[model samples]
Every structure is written in C-alpha cells, then in structure tokens.
Target: MKLLLRLATSLLLWIIMMVILVLIILLPRDMEVKRIGVKDHMSYHFTWSGYKENIQQYLADVKENKTLGTSVAHQPVEWELAHYGKRSIAILVPALIISFLIGILKGVFDYRRNRGLWKVLGEGTTWLGQSIPDFFIIIILELIISLTIHRMFPHLQLYGIEHWYNIFLPILFLSMYPAAVIANYTTQALKEEDDQDYIRTARAKGLPETIILWKHVLRNCWSKILIHFMPIILTLLSSMVIVEYMTLYRGMGTRLMEAIKIKDTIASTDTILPIETPTVIGFSLEFMIILLLAQWVNQVIKHFLIPVRKDEHT
Candidate 1:
C-alpha cells in the first residue's frame, strides 16, 4: 500500500513538472526587435503568433524527428542534449560528492559539540544558512565578489569560466545548504540517539565519546540518517541547474537558456530563430530523468533499510 502510494505521488509530481516545463517553453511572453533608427532597437509587444508558431514548429519537428534549430551547425536534438548533459554531469557529480562530504562531516562535527556552544553557534548557524534559498546564495556570493572583492583588489587575477579553479566556487556554494541541512539533522539525530538506553549504557560504562558515536549511537541511528540524503540529492541537483544558469557555465542549464533566448541569426536578413523547443524539451526531460533516478535510489535505500530497522526494534 505504501509502495503504491509512493509511486503514485512520484508520478503526479513528475507530470506536474512536465506540464510546467511545457508551459514555460510554449506560453512565454514573446518579443521581437524593432529598429527605432539604424542603430537603436525597440522592443515590440508580443502576440499569440509567436506562441502558435513555436507549438506548430515543435510538433512538426517531433513528427519528422528534425534536428535542433538553435545551434549554428546542424545538430541532432539528441546529440545536443547528450553533449550538454555530459558536461553538466561532470560538474554536478563533483558538486554532489563534495556536498555529501561537507554535510556529513559538518553534521558530525556539530553532533560532537551538542551542548551550550552547539545551540548558539551550531544550531543557529546551520538553520539560518539553510533557511536562505539557493538563488540568494548565488546572488549573495556574486555581490560579495563584485561589490567588495573586485573593488578591493582591482587588479587581482580571477579565473575564467573554463579554468579548473572556477569549478571550486560553485561547488563550495552548492555545498552550503546541503551541509547545513545534514549538520542540523545529524545534531538532532545524535541527540535522539543519545537518550536511547544503549547510548546511555555506553556512557555509563565509561566508553569514550568517539567510540560511542562511531560504534553504538551511529549503528542504531544510521538508517534514520540515511533518509536525509534523499532530500539533499534533490536539493543539490536543482541547485546545480540554477547555479549553472546564473553563472552561464557551459552545462545543460546554460544550453537550455541559450536556446530559449531570442537571438538574431542573421543581421543581414534580420532572421530570427524561435525558441529551440526540441532542445528545451530534451534538456528538461533529461534533468527530470536524473531527478527521478535519484529519487528511485533514495527509495531503494529506504526499502532495504526498513526491514533492518524493524528487526533492530524487535
């Protein structure tokens, strides 16, 4: 019954996401450029024509299995999605790993200092940071760099987008909320476990704090802790898209945005390409698949661990 419910819920969420993506692609506030004079440009109010054309073109392409129209060269929609998806995976996987490590370690660190200082410093800091949304994090960091750091050291060398070191800032930024969430959960989980008879007995037996944490409290509480990773995966994945788009990183998000944006393909003829529907749908669907897979993995872990939890209690 629970399995059926979970499946149904997931399917519903997936459908809703697909609907939203299609709307964003098909029902946009469309616009075109007009010349006020030779060099000046004016924005024209949009019409339903742009929307109609996008849907018609998109359907025709789907029927014919046509190539994506956004790129300069002829490229299959599948190829564009695959290429950019791989690039996103390369950057995001590292961010995911780093986020997990930071969250787990920081959580453990906070758990160890669970009294006095932990309440004021650990709890306050973790919850506060976690409350702020992902986009704000990126904006805050960008502002810090632009307003303060860039002004302070006007000639300081900064890494370009493609530079290896450029990956670190996004990774670090992405790691923040996940880490804070994990840390917060870890502290609470450890606290709950600390009140257990086994943990109390171990403490009464004069065992060192480290041994009790690693061997006893954790052993009993690890299954519960595993559940937290489920949400963190989603958080990290979504944040990867946002961060990549905001920074114009060469990833799936950037590709999708670029395709959706209105651009003049030919200045001579003033030819405009409509939103790359195939490319947009392709990337959005690919991202949804990855998200579904992560959710499936999380469910699998819970499914396996539930029996162990029952046995332990029995």
Candidate 2:
C-alpha cells in the first residue's frame, strides 16, 4: 500500500512537470523575419509564420536547380527527427541507468564497510557537486585542457570538434555532477539501512558479510537510490543546455542553443519536444515508461525482502 501510494505521488508530480514543460514549449515565440545563412554568408528573410513554406520553397528551388545566393535548400526532415530522437535517449536515459546501477552497487559495499566515514563523504560529495555550478567546473577543466594542449603542442590550435579529445572532456564534466549525486545518495541510504534493527538481527544470525551486504543491505537501500536518481536525470536534462553551450558539442543541448540564438521556432519546438509526444499525447509516455520500471524494481525488492508465506505455514 505504501509503495502504491508512493507510485501515485510520483506519477502526479511527473504529470505536473510534463504540463509545465509543454506550456513553456508551446507558447508561440514572437515571429520576426530574419536572414539565416551559413558562416556569415548571404541570406534570405523568413518568419516563423512562413517556416514550413520557406522550407518548401527551398526544397522546390533545389529541385528546379535554383540557388538563393549560394544557399541550396535541403530540408533535413527525416534526419532531424531521427537524430534528435536518438540523441535525447542516448544522452539522458542511459546516463541515468548507468549512474544509478554503479552508484548503488559501490555505495552499498562502501556503506557496509565504512559506516562512519561514508556518511561524511556521501553527504559532502553530493553537497559539493550540487552547490558548485556545472559551468564553473566546465570552464576550469577547459582552461586546464587548453594549457596542457598548448604546452604539449604549441603549433596545434583546436578549432572544430572533429577531435575525439574535444568531445570527451565536456561529456565527462557534465556527467560528473550527476554521478557524484548518485554515489552520495546511494552511500547515505546504505549507511542508514545498515543501522536498522533488521540489519542487526540479520548480522546476529551470523550471516557472511557478502550475503548480508547484498541480500540485506543492498536490497533494502535500492528504492532510496532510485528515487534520488529520478530527479538527477531531470536535472541532467536541464543542465544539457549549459553543457552543450560550453562544449559546442552537436547534441540536443547544442541544437537547442542554436535554435534559441537563430530564433528558429520550428527547430526550437522540435528540440523541446518531450521524449514521447509533442502535441498528440498529453502524458509523457517516455517518462511514464521510466516510472513504471522504477515501480517494478521497487516491487521486486519488496518481494525479495519480505517473502510471502505458503498455505502450508498455517
């Protein structure tokens, strides 16, 4: 009953959040005609009202072998949809899963061994990650990287993001914040679970350390870690804006920034499209799927922690 109530509460909060996201995205931007072109080249005027029409015009011009001042219209409808959809999942969803799994596993182990220091480390690490802004970390890392590169190869100047090293630094920095938060919460929850009377009872039974750690400590601490991860995923999604802006990576973050800068309504709307639906389904099916998985995990843990009795027990 408690689990169900918690699930219901989580669902309600998710719905509220989705509604807010929808309102922010759907509110029409002020339309204005602006010239858009590549690399500070010649351009043509288009407004939000005529966005589709302009795309069509560009496509038609290309089909008829016409050029608008060195620009050829190649509307990337299929590419944009496919790319953005894949990227939204690739960046946010997988990161959440990885962080939760690794954090929970290591955290439970650490808590079982070092109850005293784990508390301080867990809380302190999370607080440090949360209190410091992500951009500040990014800038500091960027400066360090810049100095290193200049020292090693003075002739080499990094411009485009074609280099593998260029891509990794930003992703690593952005990911650090969430990973720290997950580890912190996981450790704290496990420490708390370790102090429970049930754990003491299990220990009194002379269970091996490994068995107690996995079956008792981890199983009980999981739900708390999961709950922490849910909001961190949301925070990471929000932080993508800053991360992409700073790193200049061509992910959804960068795409969203580009739309805002150019005032491209279609692109901006497309970028903000929820993982599941944009205008059709009111509920976020993508987020709903995640919520369901979290609930299923909770049920599995509960069942394991408290076994049901058979009729023979009577």
Which residue pairs in candidate 1 have backbone atoms (N, alpha carbon, C) closer than 3 angstroms, thus clashing?
A: 107-183
Name the candidate that leads on TM-score: 1
Worst 10 residues of 1 by lDDT: 264-273
lDDT of 1 by residue, 24-76 (tens): 76664443546665764534455688777767876776677654344534687
Candidate 2 lDDT over residue span 96-152, tens digit each = 665666566556545554547775564555667668887887788879878898789
List candidate 1 stretches off by more than 4 Å.
Answer: 1-60, 66-73, 134-160, 262-273
What candidate 2 gets wrong by more than 4 Å, as runs, is 1-73, 84-89, 105-122, 153-167, 208-211, 262-314
